[model samples]
Target: MEEVSLGTGNWDRLTGPVREMFVAHARTWLDEQSDPSWALLDLDRLSACTMPVLLSRGSTSPSWFSMVLERLAAALPRAQRKLFEGLGPIPHVTHPQQYTAVLTEFTRPAEAGEPAPGR
Candidate 1:
């Protein structure tokens, strides 16, 4: 948990329920470590998806996460990517208002029959 806090840099900012959720799912997180399926990426299938996709990551997140998001954006036909500057892995927990605003902006275009941001 300490490692997670250090890695995310906002674990302590999470609400009690949110923190509890992570704690409750600790076993699932551990199990995912050895899950081979987790490593699989069916880009073809992803590309076939027609729905709008929002790919987000915090600026402070590890570079690998940005790489993964870039790959997804390339694979998805209508993918929009957003970087939350000054935040870490769990941006929603650390900065809910900003996260919510981002989400709202992303959906607003869709609601008005327009393309998502960055599309």
Candidate 2:
């Protein structure tokens, strides 16, 4: 549990403003009722958002933002969604340990300042 909490905090810190974007995009998703599957995220915006700061040239396109947004639209509780954002994404987790490891990494035990137990 400590590991999860600390990991989440670390992810949040690393991602910067990504949480806000995820919330905004998610809220935008919730109020609108539509077929979730076909909902294509704005890939262009996502590309820009994931782009590194130094390499950045123009504003991130909505498509680029959609990459993460699309992953989040499971109607999951906001807390869970925020949790998901902190961890980013995993390409593959074949077993329980792997999955748990990913989730455990992001969520801190207490608040941001407190330290978590070592992994």
Best by TM-score: 1
**Highest-lDDT candidate:** 1
lDDT of 1: 0.77
TM-score between candidate 2 and the true structure: 0.22
Give the C-alpha miss distance for residue 29 in model 1, angstroms.
0.6
lDDT of 1 by residue, 67-100 (tens): 7788899999989889888778666777889999
**lDDT per prediction?**
0.77, 0.36
What lDDT is obtained when candidate 2 is compared to the true structure? Answer: 0.36
Per-residue accuracy of model 2 over 1-119 as CA lDDT, tens digit each: 11322232333343446555555676555545355655555544544442112111111223333444545443222213222332323212112354455456544454757454332
* Clash tally, candidates in order: 0, 24
